[model samples]
Target: MEKTVSAHHACVRTAFENTVPAAPPTSDDIWQTPPPAPAAGMLDVCGRERRLVTRTRERHTAVRQLPDSGSTLENVCRTLQLDRSTVRRFARATSIDELLVKATNRSTILGRYKPHLHQRWNEGCHTSAQLHQEIVALGFTGSLQTVRRYLRPFKAATVAPPARRPAPRPRRIVRWIMTDPGNLTADDAADLKEVRTSCPELDAVTHHVRDFAAMMLDLRGDQLPAWMERVLADDLPSLHSLINGLSRDIDAVTAGLSTPWSSGQVEGQVTRTKLLKRQGFGRANLDFLRKRVLLTP
Candidate 1:
């Protein structure tokens, strides 16, 4: 009886052990909680990590801001700590037509028929589609009909009537002359005077130009000596600054006094640049023109 009872107890123990399977892993199973995954970072094309605190657009990222004191393109570029390429791009793109094309590109089509388009498209009979078809014949896979539709918007976008692109715009023709007060005609000067008077800084700049133009046009060699002596003796800061800037250019400035040549050679080069630019018909870039000019020389 004792043996049978002992055997029954051993069987019960074995049944209990068999009823329970091994438990799954709990907190004790892990060696350490894996460090939280590194916060997501931007990756470059090469798969290198680049962490930017905050993303900003390239175009909106200004090197510096101007006080809007009516500076020239060249001055604005320098003051703003910007590259000339960017400044020229911005300056030449003031017009809606110029700005619009960049926004919508039909430029690739226009390149082929450039100088001719200035004559033909300027005359107004040819449609953009017609032009596109012509280009298609030359192997452009782009939609031919879309050309006219693209160009149609430009007609309305021009700054002045019949394709006169004003500031920050590149029209089919008209080139930008300097915006300096010295560059203006008498009528334009008077108008700009009114404009300058409303802005004190601009007024100061205009007055400066007026003085410089007077000195350049009125003062003869003998007269210049007296005027320059007065400026030097007076210790005028503005005059000093002007002289300092122009001192390096003394040869160019005084060349007319000595020889029959003024900046006519330089002016001729500039005219050639403008003509070469006209070949680009407002589309040619400085590098392209430079290549042609440098290569020609």
Candidate 2:
């Protein structure tokens, strides 16, 4: 019994000694130090270096194709827009195939956390700000912008299509729908028909807009009162306000629509004045701007 108890105690002591906690890794041990430079004949090149190599190969081909002449080096330098020494070096290269090589981006600190990020993305944690916070807790030492750039493609791919099509701007849609039916394409007419069917309020507004446009184009001031009454009966707040303003100036509105004479010349002068003002911006005073507008033929 004494022998068995002694052996058990010895085993326990051995186990305890074997399980002693290891020292934590130092900062230097955690980070991998980069080599001074890539070794010669490495396949991986940066984008700029790869472009240079391609351009060099093309120039070399051009140089080799030229007929042998007294000034071959000078001719290559002038024609190919390359330096004398560069052309000579390319001439010596035995094979252009060796220039084509693979390009690899240098690894960043965030590389270690890429697997975790992808796993989180697959698990539905799509917000980069939130992911950045979570990875920071897991010992990531990269910026939020870096995380955002890396996840852009994944987010774009995962976005859901909108449930309903967005409506065009109110004025633009109104103009297109109210214009002469012959002026609109079949597709536009179909779209307008769809919109009118979906929204009864918009359908009412479309009818009012068409009536107003026809009255303006045909000079039918006699129909203005009935049009105003019909529009007032509708639920269009925007058109209601416009008709109310016209009601306050009914005589002027009716006369302008009925009479052949228009304020078009006055409007043209105003437009020309504004244009001249813009052209002489910063340098012209009000007097100079006025002179340019009035004096110019």
Candidate 3:
């Protein structure tokens, strides 16, 4: 019987995940659920690589403290309250330095004029104001603060360009994907738009997610097969697995989408029964526990 059941019901990673309440979800409930959080692994726009490095170091340290950490990615994810993707990324990393490389290795607009900045600094132009003015005259449109921060790291370097890697861009991709567009911050909207424009694959994902959201909002379960077909047609391997999951119990999923029936009461009873069973450990026999659970008001 267990083998006959749909894995979608048991698997943490499935085609779609919802956190509906005990009752059938209303339109509001759909929106009120915790929005999908995207890659929860970006450093703030602070000027310190150390800040990001420290965070990556902490995650790596936590991973080491667990037994056979690679095989226990889910356990680590729960302990850290991190996204599964983030946790998987940590588990796959060869070392802290490797993870830090991804966190640190990024390009920025300020990259193009490094040579001029280095030349001026080496020629005794130590003042950021002068450097900023010079670079601005050379068509640099970035703020004077960019120049100052770039030069600040130089204070500790030995005349070479500081090994200071740029911080990864602030990614609310997952959050934006999971959240209603109406609820996004202006900055978040702009960032999401930019990300979609930059990566066609991510843009496709955004479109698919919004499509799924529409299906849910309108209870369009009949559209489920069509949606799966669309996903299958796409080049996204990640979503293909989800389509496979849905196919396992397409009829049930379709019914669920078309109707409001839910097993809330039965699920509640099961939860209560489990609670009672745990409480009765070493104190009551199975017969007594069963009677207590079934007879309790």
C-alpha lDDT score of every prediction, in listed order: 0.41, 0.59, 0.61
TM-score: the better of candidates 1 and 3: 3
Estimate the TM-score of every prediction. Answer: 0.25, 0.41, 0.48
Pairs in steric clash, model 3:
36-178, 38-174, 38-175
**Candidate 1: where is the Cα deviation over 4 Å?**
1-190, 221-244, 249-297
Please write out the lDDT profile of model 3 over residues 1-297, one tens digit for every residue.
Answer: 111111111121111111221222233544566322221123332334357668888887777676374547777778888898987777665456446544543445555456567667777789999888876765567998988986886776657342222222223346666688999977568656755655565566778888888888888998988888887886776688788888999998888888877889899989998888888777899899979987988
- TM-score, predicted candidate 2 vs. hidden true structure: 0.41
Decreasing TM-score order of the candidates: 3, 2, 1
Q: After superposition, which runs of candidate 2 have C-alpha atoms over 4 Å from their true positions?
A: 1-172, 277-291
Candidate 1 lDDT, 44-126, residue by residue in tens: 21233332312212232332233245667678777767787876664543233222223322234333233333344556645
- For 1-297, candidate 2 gives per-residue lDDT tens digits of 111112122222223223322232223434653211111121211212445455656776787786355556788789878888877866754445322221112235664455456667777889899988877776668899988886775655554211111232233345566679889977568656755665566667668778887898899988899999998897665577788899899999999877778889999999988888889867899899878988987
Best by TM-score: 3
**TM-score between model 1 and native:** 0.25
Q: Considering only N, C-alpha and C atoms within 3 Å, which residue pairs clash in candidate 2?
A: none
Worst 10-residue lDDT window, candidate 2: 36-45
Q: How well does model 3 score by local distance difference test?
A: 0.61
